[model samples]
Target: MSDTHRWVEIERVEPGVFRARNARGGELHVAGDGGELFTPVELLMVAIAACSAADVDVITSRRAEPEELRARVDAHKVRDETGNSLRDIQVTFTARFAEGEAGDAARAALPRAVQTSHDRSCTVSRTVEAGTPVQVLLA
Candidate 1:
């Protein structure tokens, strides 16, 4: 796989359901019916949040491991004449550290880590915030 290019192949598993496979053998199921699998919109939100969370964790965890860490993404799914889109997307993170000097160091680093991720390091959230044109073609 080329570093400059990322790709995933999605194949229909059944009506209203599909599986997306990456070159590294990662797979996720997407479904539009019955709420059994992750919907495409949810996957998008997950990607955005996970990217930032991973960035923040990698930076902060070096100081001290977090006792608890979680990330959540919220947005309005809008459908209108313009088409379906997400608006006012927000990613939130909750982190906790054990009581100790190392924990204090990590606690102090948390805000900066999150800020840096949101402002620069995280590609997914940055891309979403900056916006980009996605070109689709038949294959």
Candidate 2:
């Protein structure tokens, strides 16, 4: 087997809107207001959100009782001295669960799940931290 970068193609659906298909046959839609291009940072944000949700789902499913699960992840990128790529990134994860006796356990597992996503699973997190550039514009 050879190392090959999996191909995912994106097509411009409309002004500032795009559609993409992943290697795993997943389709995604991306759009923006003001007819501006969707920056890679926005994709990173999407990735973080997706990963956090995936982690929460895994954790919640392992529990004995089926508890409602929800999560939010916020990431901030610090710029380099020369205003080039991102220098540092901080991500915060918040997870909420249905009321139950295992509430504490559920809460405690949130961090672990996030860590797993960041360290082991999330391709978006890994890609962003590895070197993908991110730029934010204020409307």
Candidate 3:
């Protein structure tokens, strides 16, 4: 299988602010601190949650439209010998289905959908869990 190459160009917008643009022209602002823009750490959590949500949504929505489905990703910012990093990362899901046969079917599939996403489908969560190393290069 061929995987799409993912890359983004982060251009400095101002002091402590940057804009990340993907090849398709999507852009989002980022910051380290002191701004409305999402911090890098927060973006990481979003990635984990969004990736799982995508996988789970596709699976469960096929059964029935979701009444409500959301994931909350959180972690503790810690400074240790390992330097600044996150710990105790958690991804919590809140899903609700309406009272109906279709809803019941969706409900039945919810647990499996979430598990499959976490265990095998969500690349973001898997990468984080695997402790993938980053190779930084100077341009």
Candidate 4:
């Protein structure tokens, strides 16, 4: 499917805090260190985790509806002469299914589902892996 045009407006609310508003009227609070909200890096990690979880959840549910699904993403950062950047990212997805053959089927599909999400699905993960380009405009 082709991606739709998406836009978000960001306005500074304070010295280090800003509010981001999407076309849907959703708002997100963003801030730098010492501010009260999620930092930019934290939000990036959250995006990755959420994207992967969504893909895995959908794929697994097709086989067997899961009682619970959780996803965690861990990132390692390094700052050196080369500059600061994330060195590694790891994602862990956990799911619980009903106690029956359905559960067994879900369990059996878990590994493959995760693999497919990481390797094929999950746009955020794929974009990060591809080193997506970013452009900043002054307004």
Candidate 5:
């Protein structure tokens, strides 16, 4: 396996708001108080959904290009005596393809593709399932 580490830098834009940028220079805005931008938890959900969708899309496209594709992730958060955390997460994916032999093949492969992504591929989902270690540093 290639040992490449990816990094994202987060900077405070203002009270309760921040901006994060990846090494590739892609940036996103985050808010802590449910502002106009995405919150951290929402971003996490997006990451998971996007990762799975990407894998599914590539696999499905190999059989037949989808005319339309969309993925949505819903998470339930619980806060109690123990602490606050995501209690459950659900992912839904939809794809539409042209009517033809290719479309038939793609339709047949869609379920397997999604299953493979959730069970094996989809790094973000796997990471979440495995649990991640976090460290904080003062700068």
Candidate 6:
């Protein structure tokens, strides 16, 4: 196992807005419009979507010219007696390749990318599944 302690710092800018800054100096801005309760889960879902799309890009680039790609990630959380959390995530990926290509091969690649992301690529999903500490910061 790699003992590198990967760190992600998130700072709360408002009630439902947060800025996620990484150890490598990368940053992301996230927010929600409703109550303060829903924003965090949405952020996780966005992470899944983004990571899945990235995986898809990697898969497609190896075979053909990728013109466009998009992903939609949906999650369901089941609450227990103590109002704790149990989550189920599903990601739907849609991609469009450049014309005059083998459409079947391009179409087939989407599932492989989704599997790779869910099984290997997405860090947030892995961390959450492993019950790691997810730190929340208030600015």
Misplaced by over 4 Å in model 4 are 1-3, 34-36
Structural similarity to truth (TM-score) of each candidate: 0.94, 0.60, 0.95, 0.89, 0.93, 0.69
For model 1, the superposed segments whose C-alpha errors exceed 4 Å read: 1-3
Per-residue lDDT of candidate 3, residues 2-108 (tens digit): 68888989999888999999999999999989477799899999999999999999998888888899999888999998799999999999988888998899999
TM-score of 6: 0.69
User: Each candidate's lDDT (Cα)?
Assistant: 0.90, 0.65, 0.92, 0.88, 0.91, 0.73
Residue pairs of candidate 3 with colliding backbone atoms: none
- TM-score top scorer: 3
lDDT of 2 by residue, 1-139 (tens): 5466877777888777788898898987766552354465667566667776776667755653334454454545566667644434556555556677576667767777777878877776787667767576565
lDDT by residue (13-70, candidate 5, tens digit) is 8999899999888988899977788988999999999999999999989989999989
Q: How would you encode candidate 1's per-residue C-alpha lDDT over 57-138 as one tens digit per residue? A: 9987998889899999999999999999999998889999999999999999999999999898888988887888889898
Q: What is the lDDT of residue 68 in candidate 2?
A: 49
Kindly give the stretch of ten consecutive residues in candidate 3 with the minimal lDDT sum.
Answer: 32-41
List where candidate 5 sits over 4 angstroms from the true fold.
Answer: none
lDDT score for residue 60 of model 3: 88
Lowest-lDDT window of 10 residues in candidate 1?
1-10
Count of backbone collisions within predicted model 6: 0
lDDT of 2 at 59: 74
lDDT (Cα) of model 2: 0.65
Q: Report the Cα lDDT for residue 126, model 4.
A: 97
Cα error of candidate 3 at position 56, Å? 0.7
